[model samples]
Target: MQMASTPTTGDRFRQLIRSLTGISLPPSKVQMIDQRLRRRVVEYGLPDTEAYLEKLLAGELPQDELPRVIDLITTNTTSFFRESEHFDFLTGHILPDRLAKARAEGRKRFKLWSAASSEGAEAFTAAMVLEEARRKGAGFDYAILGTDISARMLERATAAIYADEQLTTVPRDLVTRYFLRADDPSMAGKARIVPELRARTRFRHLNLMDKSYAVDRDVDVIFLRNVLIYFDATDKEQVVDRLAGHIAKGGYLLVGHAESMIVRHPLLRQVKPTIFQKC
Candidate 1:
């Protein structure tokens, strides 16, 4: 009988990953991370994960390569107009209601955070809603900030290029209006978002697990979708508490449809389906 290989590099890499990013990985993910990062190790001319881990721990790797390591690990699975119902809610329920209330109170500015904005789709979706409101002559001033831990994903988002597969979720009319043909021959079956839309968004590096986030001011809404799945119970509570602190009084928090913190916390009150109001 053949014996299974020992978990030599696996244990060390797990510690390194968790220490650097606060992302916990299960045993099944060890081989996956190894497969994904082994090429990078070779590219860096490191003999093994132990050597790479040594350099990474010592902060001796090239600055640009560090982001590649993170990019390999961070999940960037997103599409335009994802969670379509939320966009409808923004138009039909949320924005108009927030606008009316804020205007009545003599406040015109609104802030939104796409806390796990992967590849800028959700962020741009919010912008499209705000743009629609603007076209309707609404006197609302807003800023939408898209933040992610993956610098590589953010760069792609900032560029606003999308594969044909990714563009299908985007509305046809909006695509024609907002996206221009790709100029590079290498970029077939792709479209790039026009400069106008890109102007309205700002991307930043943020780790949700980090205690020190710069989003100090209260925000009207936070679209923190599809992110809590990576955390355990304790980390989930910590993340929620930190996120809730940034929500403006009576503002809302939106998580992925699959995520639940209903019995998980006391400060959040469920309003509509998949939407929570911070008390």
Candidate 2:
């Protein structure tokens, strides 16, 4: 009789990543994963990605190392207002309607969640636009929550610091209005979200795979863009359904343009190609 052979380090690594984050690692991602984890392999003096995975899966490393591993493996690509049109709809359609309803209902607070916020850019972008509305006498207050699987990203998000290049997509006036340059000589090119806007925004570490999020179920809008592309069909569906549950009735869910065709949940109705409204 033949003995059963153990799965390769890459196979177990991929499975664990999917189980933890619902992110699929296709064959095409093999090179990318190895590339991303290369630093960790060297840092631990491991022979290769396989060795690093063995240590990680066996819990042989520090208690805190697993989170750091997840951070390195997960992709976090974002920019301020990467999809400008989303912000346009946000300020033009959603805000007006939500604000009007708020005024009529005697409510002052509005909430927006960046479901996969990376380094706080999207959340801060929303903050900038919402703050502008308040300045124009929209007369409503808002709080923004940014959640990511990467603690490294969340820490940077909480810091609210951004490089100058990251502000290119942000309009000049808004940049001046919302950011303050770092005084530290070592951080010259970086700027941070001003106190007022930073005060209204917060970041937390969250895995969308969790059965329930520790977020407000009455959230007004959720920007769950870009991140779903990493998930498989089943995982993607589960994530959307879970996200939809957190949205208040009549609130909105925005996905990436590439993911527009993928949003098909019973609780959500497509009002636009990439925009869905909760029923």
Candidate 3:
């Protein structure tokens, strides 16, 4: 008796994922993707990765499935205040001066966008800073909007729950003032952001690859940190242009400390390391 061969479904699946997401999957990632999407394959009644790729190629999967694929692909390594210097730049140099100038011009409100907000830390961190400014009588009306392609992470962001281990980078003062320690014994070592801080920021589902994004025209700042490394050069350009389009004139674009726009984009000018001003 002869048995049917179990095909190299994982390798083919990796290729399909790379084609769609521009994520170059290595042989080492085969098992990772298989584990992440095995349930989806089962749920779809697909026999193997080949069949799954066929469905994705044919657009037969539900709309939400694509983001699930993105979730599996995009690396979202982030923590509360993971890159602290950017926040320092915001508080010390950017906010104080931008707020003063806008107030003098009678512009009473501002908006900020955290374009690749993962797990809500960056957005909420912005809120904490803005809240402090507001309390100090800076008198600038402000709100922060955080968007990401990962629905799973966005759900966690909305829930505002975190283990103490996840918050190692957050400031001690913020941990004390903003997060309520979970009282239940089983949930000890966990905390939730206080309602006031949570209320100050909004989370939304946004895909960088989506054809259109309706960002507010007068956005004062955009933080799209540490996300461009995944995209190819062309994708990097497009995403930069899209995110930069939302910046109000004289507003700034902040990328990761190691990321840059030195690639001849006509719409931006470098004002500082990893910072660009919309022209």
Which candidate achieves the best lDDT against the true structure?
A: 2
Quality of model 2 by C-alpha lDDT: 0.91
Tell me which of candidates 1 and 2 scores higher on TM-score.
2
Q: TM-scores of the models, in the given order?
A: 0.88, 0.95, 0.83
Model 2 lDDT tens row, 55-97: 9889898999878878988889999988999999999999987
Q: lDDT of each prediction vs. the true structure? A: 0.80, 0.91, 0.79
Query: What's the CA error at residue 62 for candidate 1, in Å?
Result: 3.8
lDDT by residue for model 3 (1-279), tens:
899776465666666665665566777876776677778889889897668866876688898888787786677778777678788888777787677768778897768899989889888888877777778787777888899878888998898888999878877887888889766896788899889988778899887866568778778889989887766677778778777778888788888876875334677788887877777
**Between prediction 1 and prediction 2, which has the larger lDDT?**
2
Candidate 3 runs further than 4 Å off: 1-32, 38-65, 261-263
Cα error, candidate 3, residue 252 (Å)? 0.9
TM-score of 1: 0.88
Ranking by TM-score: 2, 1, 3
Candidate number with the higher TM-score (2 or 3): 2
Worst 10 residues of 2 by lDDT: 99-108
Q: Number of the top candidate by TM-score?
A: 2
Instruction: Please give the distance, in angstroms, between residue 7's alpha carbon in candidate 1 and its true position after superposition.
Output: 9.5
